[model samples]
Target chain A: MNKRRAARRRGLAASDDVMWSLMQAAHAVESQLEEALAQVELSGAKLAALTQLVEAGEPVALGELAARCACVRSNITQLVDRLEADKLVRRVDDAADRRSLRAAITPLGRERQAAGAKKVDEVRRKLGKALGAIDHAALKRALSDLD
Target chain B: MNKRRAARRRGLAASDDVMWSLMQAAHAVESQLEEALAQVELSGAKLAALTQLVEAGEPVALGELAARCACVRSNITQLVDRLEADKLVRRVDDAADRRSLRAAITPLGRERQAAGAKKVDEVRRKLGKALGAIDHAALKRALSDLD
Candidate 1:
């Protein structure tokens, strides 16, 4: 009556193992990156926000930050609150729109972002070395396909 | 002094792009899996715990479950509480030690886990097919190295 069930592996299928391996590897890499960012007192989201501000070279509207961050206004509000508390970013009145508020990265924010990014790079390089034993060309192809 | 920075690409390095591709692919696959599990009111963590319980075929000690789940005991406690509230699991006093508690899977939990596992398998199969163009043996080698 349930031949499929009997035919199935005791725990997971081959695809499941492959998928789980991908998640596990990502988690491992992310944890290391998070640790590197944490040393600079910056979380991933905070750095991302600061990066956008630094790239913009001007304050970005809260609404725009929300859109770029792929989050809602309230979450961006809370995230900005955290960033503001850290003195890494400041909320300023938008000259373009008086009613709106914009986020600008402080000098310290730029410094910390730079430092955190370097740390992240170091970790990535280390990861690259650790994963270097394999064929990078093939790995890149597999990864790009997942995109 | 700034030669390294100048040598770097505008945004990310080759290694950074590779690392990011890994994260992006993992995120894409995980999002698809999460969407499938959401229909059964099960999260990755919830299903993980349920799967352990179903496999154990008996109540599992909280501490032991935490160790098995690679989480702290307190996190396991809260997770168990959530599972209990969802009627997927119940807490029972451990016979070996009355002060400690163990988690037992409900019949409903078993049914849902079976269904959820089916959905996960389906998604994994789809992903496998999507990625089937690549050599799985090589990919598996790369993934195993990440471990």
Candidate 2:
């Protein structure tokens, strides 16, 4: 097994295994969340953007929204476009800075977000129950170290 | 903070935080790997399929490749199409089983996979160094539980 040991020391084999596990775990969590979001007819991306609007409790500038979403301004533009097409959000000219544009959540957006959150919470609770025996505190710590 | 406590009890806030961290950590690792793979003109999906072929050390059925890659057969079909377009792999009819298709790696495929592995190993080693302080054994178990 010296070959395996050498590969491990080179951070090849062991790291590959560990990294793959991390990704698979993340995928498991994401897939459940995706399913829950689908029930509400909201994609993970759409819900994320809508949720940001809900949390802001007011219109947010497109640039600021992009920053908050950790997405590029161009992507945010397209996302906002989709949200607008869905009638969940609208593009409003920034009152204070006419040159800037902002995204405002419509009533439909808030309603949909609340629905999506409810569905998402069900999956989260199920997840917590399923993983309850797993040391969440340790898992949380380990995940943070990755970031 | 009663709402916060109630939310935690319901497994909403805490799970969301933990789950979000997990996805973000996965993203961090994935982003680094993606950037590295891009250097060799390889996407993660392509590399994963190519790596599977390399590990098999022989022509493998497309269905088996899908199973190994944990991808849908339909998705694998598209992926193989792209790989074939890149001239990394070619499809050959399985002799023992008529009407069955298998993927055989080309010499170029082997060469590219070796090159890709070298680049990937560099990132994996860097990941190992960065996460060296963390408890890998515990992390691996926790992640496996997720799957």
Candidate 3:
């Protein structure tokens, strides 16, 4: 016996159900966010990238952006390519390290990112209110523990 | 403002974070379980199908098994083919519905499922105890509200 199966047989609670429900809920929310961002031609990953750029207040190295997104370097390359093609971002050679490149959000990207962020903010608020009605403290505690 | 994103921004207890954590945890558990199951030549999905068949105690239709597994019928077909090749499961003609085929877990499949389930149960218990320090009801409630 490893771990989860033991928990299931003991009937402490259906660990599988707990885990599955969590995945399902996350997937549902992610799908909803993707749909919401579609109008702005952004995926959740793209939106998250833009947000990172906004908070940085300056162009960040491609590697740094990828790390923040928790995605692969190749994936970041594709994401940056799409954003750059849309004129929402630009990749410039790093002045300090010529071999390294930095990604900067364009003025247009800033406006678009701001607009999309408002929508994201609204969605988060509703989720908070609903979760607050349940067990807000517990949820917060779990997240804090993970970090 | 879609529902989830707003809640995330508010920094109000985020069901999203809880959900993400749960998923990450589950993936970790699954990877561990698979490491053991690999010795028996079974993947998680195959093991799940075998378990379902054992629980049914009779031939189970492919479509029904697919639904139970939350997978597409085509995926089930491929899985069944692999299982059949391994002689762990077999496809039998449905007497009532010739158009459909019933999948039956062989004696070997049942034994494998039991052993796998036991190991999985064990791992799950440890996981539950580890997470026991956290509030699960709060997590469940927050996840439920998302629906």
Report the C-alpha lDDT of model 1 over A1-147, residue by residue, as the tens digit.
122221131233323356766776777787888888899888777877777677678999999887766568898899999999999999999877788999988999889889877988898788788888777767766866764
- A-chain TM-score per prediction? 0.83, 0.86, 0.81
The alpha-carbon lDDT assigned to residue B143 of candidate 1 equals 68
True-structure RMSD, every candidate: 6.2, 6.0, 6.9
Over the full model, what C-alpha lDDT does candidate 3 score relative to the true structure?
A: 0.69
Q: Tell me the spans in candidate 3 whose CA falls farther than 4 Å from its real position.
A: A1-17, A81-87, A95-99, B1-50, B57-62, B73-116, B133-139
Model 1 Cα shift for residue A130 (angstroms): 1.3
Would candidate 1 be rated incorrect, acceptable, medium or high by CAPRI criteria? acceptable
* Model 1 lDDT tens row, B1-147: 122221131222323355776776787788888899999888877887787788778899999787767678998889999999999999998877878899999999898788888878888888788888887766766765664
Q: Compared with the true structure, what per-residue lDDT tens digits does model 2 show for residues A1-147?
A: 432332232222333366767777778888998888888888878887887787778899999888766678999999999999999999999878988998999999989988988888787677677676778877777776765
The best candidate in terms of DockQ: 1
TM-score of 2: 0.81
Per-prediction DockQ, in order? 0.29, 0.28, 0.20
How would you encode candidate 3's per-residue C-alpha lDDT over B1-147 as one tens digit per residue?
Answer: 232443333222234554344334444565776776776676777787887777667988999888766678999999999999989999999989889999988888888887777766665566556567776665655665664
TM-scores, all candidates, are 0.87, 0.81, 0.65
Q: Relative to the unseen true structure, what is the C-alpha lDDT of residue A42 in candidate 2, on a scale of 0 to 100?
A: 89
Which is the leading candidate under TM-score? Answer: 1
lDDT of 3 at A99: 82
Off by over 4 Å in 2: A1-16, A95-99, B1-16, B61-63, B93-101
